[model samples]
Target: MSEYKFLTGLTSGFTPVIDAGFSLEDYRHIDLSVQNEILSQAQLDAPEAFQKYLDNFLLAQGGQIPWGGYNEHRGLYRRSGLFSAATEEDLIRNIHIGLDVWAPVGTGVLAVLDGRIHSFKDNNNFGDYGPTIILEHEFEAGKFYTLYGHLQRESLKDLQAGEKVKQGERIAALGDASENGNYAPHLHFQIIHDLQGKEGDYPGVANRKELEFYLSNCPDPNLLLKMN
Candidate 1:
């Protein structure tokens, strides 16, 4: 399917990451590029330092969500070995495929559309997705999926495969470092055109060589959130 059709219903639809009182006015776009001052100031390798950065950022901006990750080449990944390949020859996955909402731990995460639970798993490794959930949505164009990564462990409790999730329903909560792969609390939201038959997990970052394919498959999540 053409990439344009992948975001057909979602762009003109509702917000998916937060509960209420969320707006573009309440959002501060985050910069992870090498030129960004925020990255230079914060000690990203330390969880506490990163958390302090997030806390101060939100407090100063009065924003509920610090969003922006689609196709962004981030230097912050250097702090985590998980983003590195076993060998130097292999391209590293630093380009973010999803839009992340940095919020307090235990923040409620919602679904943007009606769908069923495609799969859920705890990818419990450092710099991994932690407790993740993939929801399958049936759109007129075709079947696609929405992935919610870095969620609280309790969010997946008693969740059955193929369980129905309605539009705007609470599906999960923001997880902390201990449960969310040791990063600051946030919801890693991505729209996947195809899962490639993978379940429970999919790549949230792309190698530079296959950048085009991953970029096309995972369009800017703001297309769904419409947060300006």
Candidate 2:
């Protein structure tokens, strides 16, 4: 079966990755892409300033969680050398491949499905997913993975590879800017068809040149999230 068909089959309704206390009604789609005119380049490069913009956005929309980013062409990654292009010919990895759930620090992050821990790591790069976790799930046809990034430190301290986690289980908590690669507190949730032998991490962003392949490998998180 195709990736879209398989992913949509995995969940029957809105699957909560952030704290379950916040219902689907609390989720509001946010645009962080270049299309959003209000997002200045300077603010996108500053975590505190970017966070303030997010705060005002939520307040203005009367939203608790501003969730979006899958396949979005964003200007948010230009801040970090990890994703920035050094030369004019270099490919810029600014298209986000994962769905970002914006929330406060220490918010509970739950497993979207039953799976075993694949690996864990603390990616400390300035624009990286700090304290990452990848979980492996098996189906009749094959296996796939879900990655939880930008997590609190304690989430990894007690975790081990191959650990079993059930759906809705508290697997991690959102991390603040200090520990979570200097981004505002949020969960970068990605679903990967092929991990490409990586662990505790995977490309959460892609460039225009490689957009097609990346989008196929990392299907839209909304297939499972069903957040309207």
Candidate 3:
């Protein structure tokens, strides 16, 4: 079976990764793409300003969770040399491949499906997923992986490679700007069909050239969550 079909068929209802308090009704899909005119480069360059905008956005919308960004072309990574180190235009990785759930620090991050800890690490970089964890799952004929990024360091404290994580169980907590790669507090969740031998971290964004391959490899996370 195809990876996308395998995933969508595995879940019958919405699967959430963030705190359980907020229902589907509480999630407001916020646009962080290049097309969003209200957001400026300056705001995204600074986590505080971007967070203030998000606060106001949630307030204006009367929501608790602001999520989206799968396959989105974002301008949020331009400020960091992490994504702009490439000299070629097509080599710049600007297309986001994960779903971001924006929330307060310490928000509980749950496991979407029954899986065991494949790997975990503190990928501390200027624009990186600070404390990340990858889980491996297999049911019936399908086998795949899930990545949870921007988590608190404490989440990785007692974690072991083979540690089992039950579905809907609290596995991590959201990290702030200091620990979450200098970004606002959020959970970066992604579905990966193949890790290519990488662990603890994988490319959350892809360049124009590798977009096709990455898109197919990393299926849209909504296939499982069905949040929107």
lDDT of each: 0.82, 0.90, 0.93
Residue-wise C-alpha lDDT for candidate 1, range 1-228, written one tens digit per residue: 355555755557547576655666778887766567656635677778877776777788786678877888877676667787535533887788888888788888999788999999999988899999999988777788999999999999999999999978999998999999988888899989889989889999877877888988888787778776
Can you rank all candidates by lDDT, best first?
A: 3, 2, 1
Better of 1 and 3 by lDDT: 3
Q: Pick the candidate with the highest TM-score.
A: 3
Ranking by TM-score: 3, 2, 1
**Per-prediction TM-score to the true structure, in the order listed:** 0.91, 0.96, 0.97
When 2 and 3 are scored with lDDT, the better candidate is 3
RMSD of 1: 2.1
The sequence of per-residue lDDT tens digits that candidate 3 reaches over residues 1-228 is 264786887778878898888899999999999999999999999999999999999889987899999999999989888998899999998999999999999999999999999999999999999999999999886789999999999999988999999999999999999999999999999999889999899999999999999999999999899897
Cα-based lDDT at residue 173, candidate 3: 100
What does the lDDT come to for candidate 1?
Answer: 0.82
RMSD of every candidate to native, in Å, equals 2.1, 1.3, 1.1
On the 0 to 100 scale, the lDDT of residue 187 in model 3 is 97
C-alpha lDDT of residue 228 in model 2: 92
Once superposed on the true structure, which residue ranges of model 2 sit more than 4 Å away at CA?
Answer: none
Clash pairs of candidate 2?
none
